[model samples]
Target: MTPTHPKASLLTRLARLVRMGSHIAHGFFILAVRYPHLANAERAVITRAWARKMLSIFGVEVRISGDNPGFYPPNTLLVANHVSWLDIIALSSGTVSRFVAKKEISDWPIVGTMAKNGGTLFIDRSNRRDASRINGQLADALSQGGCMSVFPEGTTSDGFGLLPFKASLFESALLAKSRVQPVAIRYLDAHGQQTGTLSYVGDHSFGLILKRLLSMKKLVVELHYGQSLQAGEGELASRFAISNAARREILAGLNLSDDTPDTARQTLACPQAVTQ
Candidate 1:
């Protein structure tokens, strides 16, 4: 927000904080008291509702295009590029799917507790055993026809191209004979240009992210869904191939160069926004 004067800037910041605080109270009440009593399907509905409100509170807007969720297979594994914590909210607002997040997020402030309530699947990356365990759990989840979304990049970058996908998660999809859906998330500024202001990266504290988010005039997020990937009878594709295909589809949606360097993808100054 380009305030004409110092006082205007300060007032704008204060007003934003007030709005943010109000939304925090409402969201916290839902998470702490309301979310627990809801059934699994109900929880997804509420989570999606809260996600939309969360973005509204932060002065963010979302535009969706391409394949619809209804067209997705009943047993689907969603793969997408990771950019910021806002990616979770943006995706959840659109899909009734559970997320695969890093286990450390379970220890974050209120968000961790909320994520748990939202049915997030936490994977302990540092523990080699955790991967195997989560894969099994994912297979079971898919077998039950649950929608699971994952960031195969294993980490977030400034909004741009994608990181190489870790192929292990694709193994779970293969085991369950589930369809894989590639999703793309992009953050744009007011002029419809890609912007790093919405990115959460580097060592910046979450507090700093909150400040940046509140101070922003607006944030525009775009989501694109690609065609589903399934294993054909008599066609055996390796997990690596599936992962590469998913990553390629996401890169295409984001309009990024294929096999681009991380440095080339994120050419902006690191102004972290939301999460890891």
Candidate 2:
């Protein structure tokens, strides 16, 4: 299901062009802020407007199922699986939440710049000390009524399944007493093949994946927002319970066969431990 070489190159070129345009749009916003009259909500409106424009320029199609924009409360933590970089753009356009991205993304050329400008929280997962520090920062952000989007899977998959949810990241939610909402995203080709090879897993480079996406005639992404789960009595128990519930909801939405590698299947089957 991987894209052909020629198509991949085209998608990359298109991605570069889109990035250039988004930068220009962002610069305009910065300049607009010189006038002291814009309030915080007004400024946010402008940024979101630009984000919508950027997505259109990049040719990413987004579809939503369950819960409109106002359905969930503010300052909630959105948990979802990782598939492509587009997941960030897609989710951001649909919700007013900052991203919790890996540290490597902060250094990723144009993509990194855009993510930082959009107020992404970059975490250095390789260092436990740094991770602990970021956890405090995340708590502060949530306390201030800011919403954050996180991918519990820790890595991207081939768009055919869900990965295990890392329970550690749920710590901030516990600290802030924030509710967790599970979101599921699926990328489909024109012919409706689930795994048309747009995944950026294994040795596949971002450049190659971007190229394939741009050359696509019609790309459709389905986003499903599952019911929100509140932090319960215990941190470990709540993390496990919410993670498993979110996992099942996502799997059901994608219509994916529950059959997979033994480990993945077992992880999905076990209910997350709950606190009293």
Candidate 3:
């Protein structure tokens, strides 16, 4: 079910107006660069505010589950599932965290600009050398108490299911000895159908989605936070275990049965005992 507002023309106008306002706000970041001391925290604040505004303009509402823990030690790494591009806006609006995304996203038109301006880390998945370089950079960022959000499921999917999480990226958590928080995001349509429009799978065009969103009256997003896991004795084991637990938490939150007959649902061995 789509939005049923009679004032389609009015909403369209409002959406464009809001987009203009966002561009203006985006420009303010250039001004922020002059003041080094205020850049970091201010950018975070501005990014969050912009995310909130964008969601508001798109008529999407966010509902969060579990404890919204404040960034502790300022070096926490959040691992979550990727749904649609909208997931970025939803999560950013709720947390002042930076994202770790694929290198291709860095070349997208307006999105590329926003991701770069928002301080997102882009990784080249096709090149092992490049991936290694990014891993090192991520380690350094976490060592310095910088928080980052990563989607362990290398790609996005419809909100109904999860993909196999790539364990390689989890190496950064071990390197920095940082806490890994599992997060789940679900998107729904106005009539409560799990439209999964949030997932950018198949041949769906970003421009087409953006136009549809402009006409949409309401969208619902759910964010579920799970227990944080610590790096264990072995990197591979630790990553596998954490990713499995995260998959379970996300599936449970969606009210789906855990007995689904899919390879992705298989559990892995736990490297170390989880505190939660």
Pick the lDDT winner: 1
Every model's TM-score: 0.84, 0.78, 0.81
Expressed as tens digits, the lDDT of each residue in 1-276 for candidate 3 is: 233432246657576668857764665555345324555667667667777777876778888887575533366777777766677778777766777766776677665665676567887666766656766777788888777778776666656676766777777777888777777888767776667554565665566566666666567788878766776545424766766766677667666656754323211211110111
Whole-model lDDT, model 1: 0.72
TM-score sort, best first: 1, 3, 2
Regions more than 4 Å wrong, model 3 = 1-39, 71-73, 108-110, 233-237, 261-276
lDDT of 1 at 44: 70
Cα-based lDDT for every prediction: 0.72, 0.64, 0.65
lDDT string, candidate 2, 157-178, tens digits: 7767777667766777778888
As a whole number from 0 to 100, the lDDT of residue 99 in candidate 2 is: 72
Model 3 worst lDDT run, 10 consecutive residues: 267-276
Instruction: Give the clash count for model 1.
Output: 1
Q: Summarize candidate 1's per-residue lDDT along 1-276 as a digit string, tens digits.
A: 222211226677787788777877787788789877876677677778877887887778988887867522467887887777678778877876887777767888887786776667787666766777788888898888888888777667776656777788778888888888888999877666787665556664457666777676767889898776884323437777888788778888988877577532431322111112
Q: How many residue pairs collide in each prediction?
A: 1, 4, 2
Please give the lDDT score for candidate 3: 0.65
